[model samples]
Each structure stands twice: as C-alpha cells, then as structure tokens.
Target: MKHIRNFCIIAHIDHGKSTLADRLLEHTKTIGERDMMNQVLDDMDLEREKGITIKSHAIQINYPYKGEEYTLNLIDTPGHVDFSYEVSRALAACEGALLLVDASQGIQAQTISNLYLALDNDLEIIPVINKIDMDGAMIPEVTDQIIDLIGCKQEDILLASGKSGIGIEAILAAIVERIPAPKGDENGQLQALIFDSVFNSFRGIIIYYRILNGSIKKGDKIQFASTGQEYFADEIGVLKLTMTPKPEVKCGDVGYLITGIKVAKEVKVGDTITLANNPAPMIKGFEEVKPMVFAGIFPVNTDDFAELRDCMEKLQLNDASLTFELETSQALGFGFRCGFLGLLHMEIIQERLEREFNQTVITTVPNVSFIAYTSKGDKIIVNNPAEMPDPTKLDRIEEPFIKAQIITLPDYIGNIMTLCLGKRGILINQSYLTTTRVELTFEMPLTEIVFDFYDKLKSQTRGYASFDYSPIGYREADIIKMDILLNGDKVDALSALIHRSRAQDFGRKLCEKLKELVPRQQFQIVIQAAIGAKILARENISAMRKDVTAKCYGGDISRKRKLLEKQKEGKKRMRQIGNVEVPQEAFLAVLKLD
Candidate 1:
C-alpha cells in the first residue's frame, strides 16, 4: 500500500491529455510499442469522431524506480463542461492530478474551471506544459502564467511534447516522487468508493471503485450505503488495458467488482460499498449533477417507443446526469422529456439511439426551465414550450440566468461586447489577464445563449475566444410565448418563448424562414406568427397558378373576366377547406435562423 500512487490527468479539451496518457503507458511498458495507439483510453466512437473525451477511463501501471517498484493508477478525465461531474468523481478517487496545459494556447476557459475543481478537492497538482515541439510554442510565457496562477516555481513546471515522447521519463519519475501514496486502514471494516460503473451483457454491473478502508475478495457479500442493497461479489480484478481477474483487492488499490446484478440501475456511481456482515461508515459522496438543458425526444415511428425507452434505460445506467420522463404531445405523439447537461450531451444521446438501437428519433427545440406564478397563487416550473400556461393565466414569469466568462484577445473586445449586448446580456465586470488578452464577464439569460451563442462567438473571434458559463438564480423577465400558425391553425411544435421587445423581428424572421422550407401546395399557404390573438408577422406563398386564359383562344374580355372571377372563388373555398401538412423540416427550420 505504501508504494501505490493514485493520480489523474486534468486539462482543457485538445490539450494533449490523452496523448500524455499514451506516452506514460509506453514509458512504464504497461502497453507494448506495437500495441500503442493514439488516445487508446478514448473508447467511444463519437468521442474519437468529435476529437473530445466523453468518458473517464482508469488504468493501472507498474513502474520500477531505483530497484523500488511503484504501482501507479491513472484516471483519464473528460475536459468538456458537460462532463464536469465525471471529472469530480475521478478527482475524488485520486490523491493528485497532472494539470496539462498547451504551451502555445496557455490557459483556456476549461483549464481554469478544471484547475479550480482540483483545488477544491485538495489534491496535489503537478503542472506540466505539453506540445513543446510545436513551432508556435511559447514555453517561457506559459511557464510564467503557471507560476502566477498556481504559485509554483518555474523549474517545477515540466516541459514535454506528448507527440514526440519528450520528457516522458521525467513525468513518470515526478509522479512516483511527488504524488503521495494512498493511505487507508487495511484491517478496518470493508469500505470502498464507486467512482464509475458499466453494464456488461454477460457479467451484469461491473463497478469501478477505490478501496479506502479494507479489502474485498471473491465471494464477499457487499452492501451499498446509499440504497442499502446487498449483493455477493462474484469476481474482483484490476484493469490492465482490460479487466484481469484477481482473488482479492486490498485497501488503497483501485479495481472493479462484479456484483452479479443484472439490472444497470441496481448500481450507481458515487455510492459507498461495504461488507454486508460488518459494514463500516460510508464515505462522503459528491453532489448530484443537475441538467442545464431540456428537450423532448420522440421516436419517428410510434411503434419504436418501447425500444427507445429500453435504449434510454441502458444509457442512463452509464450516465447518471441524463434524466427523462414520459411525455405526450398532440403534434409529436408519445415520447420522453429528456434533460441533458448541454447541447453536446443531447446530440450524443440522440446519435447513440439511432446508431446503436436503430431507432430514428425526433427532438424538439431545447429549452431552459422557467418558474411561472399563476393567478390562483400556484407556482409551476415548465421546461417545454407547450407546457406553458396561457398568457392571461400567468402572474409573472422568471427565466434561468447564467454567469458567462469569456477569454479572448483584446482586439476582439468590441465585437464580443456587441454580440453580448445584442443577446440582452448585462455586463457585470471586465478584467485584463495580460496586455494582449482580456476577460469579460456577463450575466445573461440562459435561453439567449443555449443555441447559437457559442457558434457566433467562434465566428466573431475567428476561433480565438474560449467561453464557459454556470447557472445563477432565476430573474424576472418580460417573456412571452409566441406561436406559429399554418393555414390559420396553431402548431404546437413551433411555439417559442421570446421577449416582447424582439417579438416582431423574431416572428418575421421565423415566418420568412418557414416559408422557404415549407413545400408548395395546390392552394396558397399562409404562414403567420402570433402572440395570443394578435398576429405579428405573415407571409403568403401563392398557389401554383394554372393559366385559365390559356384555354380561351379568342374569347371576349368580359368572358375572360368572368372565368377569372370564378377561378378566384374556387381557390378561396379550397384554401378554407384544405388541410396543410407541415413537414418535420419546417418545425426545425426556426432553430437555424440568425
């Protein structure tokens, strides 16, 4: 136990965290040269395609230093804000963290956020500068930034290039020397902290845990402190690239336990595991993750509802942050109101459903929860636009707010401020990190930036700015629910929440966009945007005209007029009686408007 070192790698996205992990595996000879691959820890296909880490992975390596063998356990964590909960859990299971910063990019938004998380956990941080081989590398400037940020000596910051394997031996030596070994009571009652879990079709729920107080072995009966569920441990093992079975897992060791539980929901992350016979006190667990965005997910085919539900259940077992409930829409039919951490999380879930389960799905517009006070002295929280109460029945409406932090070059300050103000953002504070870069803070409505804010920011700054935000308390706002009407009938799927001041402009843009997306029909289609009984904007798509005059070769002018009048009357009746079928693309077109 004295020779065991447990640590994790933390960094912003695309900062060479995974590459560093690969190099460490090579330096320790845990994985052979032929088996070496880029981002071997990132196992998900979507993660590889998007070039981001979506899941946290843990591995054990054996390193020998000066005739003394040391056991090193490294946990690779996701850098995106959506997976911050996973990062926190990984941090809780470790004694130290390797903070990787890009030598050229310096510190980014996520880098600052993750560094604060490590600090909160009270873990020893080993600052390492990566990508030194790049031509644009600014090692000296980044070293000074690290010194100012963490108050560490300039020499303490290790320089390495993950791609070229530079300083690989030095990083491993630092981990063995600087990171403290895990301390636990081997003779105490059995207690362990489950940091992650995965469901296997053959083995049931495989729990990844860190032993804190005692030991666990095959045939030992274990109990969960949170759920009070007991199960017999069928197998115990450590992961060496893959699970390798062992007879026992001692205190301060990281490994997995096969609980023989078939259901995924039976096991949970952040739960304490202890012996059923003589259980010890439970360890402190992290707070539950709250979702930031909510949307409705319905199957394109109504018969696939059961399959969709089953797929979601399996996914929820691996992802604790995902939340969903049964919901029905008159326009969309039966589906789930799903809650996600952010847009990326939502997109990944949808993609998995389609690719893994072969079930096509339709997702409604994403929205934030709003608190509505009713005239009858009742408070209601709504996440879907259709669930909103009638305009007259509400006393007041409060929308979720977020505190946004944007870091960028000083030259782009004017463009960023203009974009922020256009989204109804209130400038709270501003500061300078250096003479060339600025940090701007704003308090804005969550709904304003939930969709196009990041894209627009990237476009304005030419991809130089980094942004991060967190939810604050709700604030009162002059918000109104706007509806889209096709052929004089309101479509529930196209309703949106907008401020009164921008309602006219928003409605006009939506109407114009919808007109282009909706297919032409035999009769004229009238697209209208309305707020309650008042119509804000309307667009007319004329009917496909057939030449009534073409048929009359040499008719009198009066006869032609009569024929045209009859044709006009016939078209009017058809418009009133005909039903307009709005396609799926029309409903989703409103999301793409600027």
Candidate 2:
C-alpha cells in the first residue's frame, strides 16, 4: 500500500479554503499548463457565483518530499454552519484537517465551531494562517491565538498566503511530516462507508467510498450493508486530482465504485459497501441531520410543475442534504415544502435547481422555525396561512429561536446593534480580536433573521460582516397568530404570527411591499391593511380599463352575456365588506413581504 494522507481543508466562509486548495493543486504540479482551470475543486459553477461551498468535494495529488512520493487525498468541505452536517460527513472520510485562519481577521465563531467538531472527531489538526499577502497581515498574533485557544504546539501551525503562493512549499512539508497515513484492518472483510455518490447519465451511479478493510477488484460481488442488495463491480476508479478517466482504485484507497447501477433509490449516502458474501459491523459514528429552515417552492408557470418535480428528484439523488414534500397553499396552487440546512444552503439549492433544470420558480419567504400551537384540545403544526388559528382559539404558540454569532470590524458595531434591537434581539456577550474586530453574540429569534434581516445586516456593515448561527432553546414570547382575509375568507398563504405591538405595522408594510411586487388586477382591486378590529391602510386599484372593451359581446351575444354575468358574479364573490377588491396577487404579495 502507498503512504496516503487523507485530510480536509476547513475554515470559516471565504477564509481562502478554496483558494488554498487551488494553490496546492498548482504547487504540487497536479495541473498541467494546458489545464488552465482556477479553483478546480470548486467544480460547480453555481458554487463560484455565490462565493460559498455548497458541497463536499475531493481530489488526489502525488507530492515528492525528501526523495519520497506521498499520496495526498485532499477533501474540500463547506464552511457555512448550515452545511455543517455535510462537513461532519466529510470529516469522517479524513484522517486529519488543515484548519485555515485568515491572517487579517484571526479566529472567528465559525472557526471555533469547526475546530470543536474536528476535536470531537479525534482528527489531527494542522493550523495554517492564510492571506499573508493582504495588507495589515498579522501572522504571529493569529498563531499566538491558535496556540492559546486551541492548546496546540506552536510549531505545528504553518503560515502561508493561499493567494500569492507564499509558504505553500512549507505547507506541503508540514502535511508530509505532521499528518499521519491511513490505517485499517488489512485482513478483515471488505467493508467501506459510502460518504458520497453521483449518478451520471452514461456511467450510472458513481459511488464514492472509503475502504475500511480488505479488498475487492472487478468481478467481485458486493452487497450494500444497509439494503442487503448485491451487485458486481463492473468498474472501480479514483478521481484523478488531474485527469479524466480516473485510475483504478483499490483497498485503503478513496475512490469511486461503479456497479453499473441505474436505480437512484438503491444507492444512498451513509450506506455501507461490503462484500456480498461477508459483512462486518457498521461504523460507530454516523448521525442524521435534521433540517433547521424551510420554504415553499413552486413553478412560476403552472405548466412547468412536472418538470420542476423531475429536476428536484434528480438533484436529490446526489444531494441527500435537501428535504421536500408535496404541499399546497390557497395563494399558490401547488408546490413543495423544501427543507434546507440554513439560509445560504436554501438559496444555493434554489439557484441550482432553477439553472440546472431550466425552470423558473416563485419561492416563499424562508422560515427559520416551525411553530406548534396547542390550544384547548386542538393540536396544530403552524407552517402556513391555513394552519394559523384565530387568536381567540389559541392558548399558547411556541416559536424557535437561534444563538447567532457575528464577526465584524469595529466601525459598524453601532449600526448592527441598532438593527438587531429593532428585531427584538437580546444581547448575549461580546469578545474581541485584538482591538479592531469583535465577536458579538446575540440571542435572536430565528424568524427575524430569515427574512430581510440578512440583507439589512449586509447593508449596515458595508459587506464587512460574517455570521453563523445554531438552534437555541425555545422561548415563550408574546406571539399573535395573525390571519390575512381576502375579502371575507381567510388566505392560508398569507398567514403569520407577529408580536402584538408590531402587528399593525407588519400588516401595513406587507400590504405596501405587495403593492410593489404584484401587477395591477384586471378589475379594480382593493388592498386593505387591517388589524383585528380596524383597517390601518387602504389602496384603490383602478378598474380593468382597456380589457373586454374590444369586441364587446360581438358574435354569439348569449355567450358574451354569459361571460359578463360570470365576471360580475366573480366580483360579487369577492368580499367588499370595506370597499376593497382584493386580487389574487395581493395574497401572494403579502406572503413575500415581511
């Protein structure tokens, strides 16, 4: 067996993890002059556009050091907290981690969280401070913080600039000397854990597995430890850090296992790939992640619903991180309730689904928590407008909250404080990085941050802020289940709960934002913003001035009269209790507003 060092590069979002990987690929001569691709591990176009890592990817390169060749299996993982579950899975496939800390920014909340996870895995960590080429770099201070906070040896932390190729050779030397080789039972049964897989149109399901023990080659039968289904290995190959048609991989190797499989339901992440005739005990440390945020996704054009469904299913084949179910709303005809790891993950998934599937969609406001209301003997899972109960019928409603950690420069601290206070934020504590940057922790309701909160924060900070959050304990705050009534009936798609003090303002803002989003109604549409007993604001939509004027009841006068009668009847069905002609878009618009 070859000397293999399997490791993953982990850091906070945009700390140069991808850039470091790119530098390594170039430094080790893994890419040729003709290859000409930048940030090769960021293979997906969608990932680059968003400036975030959405998936866990890997590559292999052979580096020569001290007259010897060492095989480096480099795994790249998402740094965002939403995708932390995937990060754990990726960590399971590696023996060590290269923790990248930005020289200018120093340690962050995400960096601490990621470091804690690595420690739990018992993985050897090699700290490397990156971005040394930038102005105001502080390599020694960050190195001191790593040693003081993490209690690691001072010499173990390497300093480098991933962007300028500075200290890259030293990083390679540290990897060869500090990180250990892979170890497993050489004589045990042929067992492996399938961390990730991909289904190509031509090659079928290309399963990626790390061999735990024993060995198998072409013609050997393998059984899925989870499903007990068996298949023959038609082909086996390693993802060449640098070429197509990857080389064949064997035991103690991290590579792709092609079984000539065509079924999507058969292969799953976290499944076990073992010999068909013999099996071993399952690995001890795998955990299923529960989604923390959700939203409703629907095709802009109803005709494309089927296409959207197919694309979602196809995307789910590779990304087991996403969750969805068939859902419907009075405002939206039919759609799927999609679950995501976090806000960024939710946006990335939506963007990829649209671009890859060629489908345009209308997405609801992303929700951070699913409130459950139990009043009297009734039980309700309040997620949408229809599920929201009347205020009088409710006894108590439970909402989810989050523990948010923000890292930012000192200049915008006052603005962030004001914005958080407006969202009913409670201060937790504060820490500082030297004297310039501060780590401010806050206990904010998840619902407040899911909406325009992110955009608002970015605007206030001039894009200098970074955020990470996790679920905190639930709290009982003043909650009101507000319902939106179109005319006289309730609209499920436009239902939400707001604090008593903000109910009127929330309603008014929602109505206004809706007016801006939705087009004019065919008939004179009336938009009224109302609280329980009083109307706060009202707008008069002009009547359908030009529509139906041309060829009015021309040929087939009876049919024309019938149509006009139907239109009038439709108008009557609309509630005119307060001289308001509520259009369909009004409900949709309200749903998207706050």
User: Which candidate number maximizes TM-score?
Assistant: 1
lDDT of 1 at 472: 91
Tens digits of per-residue lDDT for model 2 on 421-490?
8898998988786676788889988778766777788889997888878887777767765555444455
> What's the lDDT of the predicted structure labeled candidate 2?
0.76
- In candidate 2, the residue pairs with backbone N, CA or C atoms under 3 Å apart (3 or more residues apart, or in different chains) clash, namely 385-492, 386-492, 526-581
Per-candidate local distance difference test: 0.88, 0.76
Return the clash pairs for model 1, or none. none
lDDT of model number 1: 0.88
How far off is residue 473 in model 2, in Å?
2.9
TM-score of each predicted structure versus truth: 0.95, 0.87
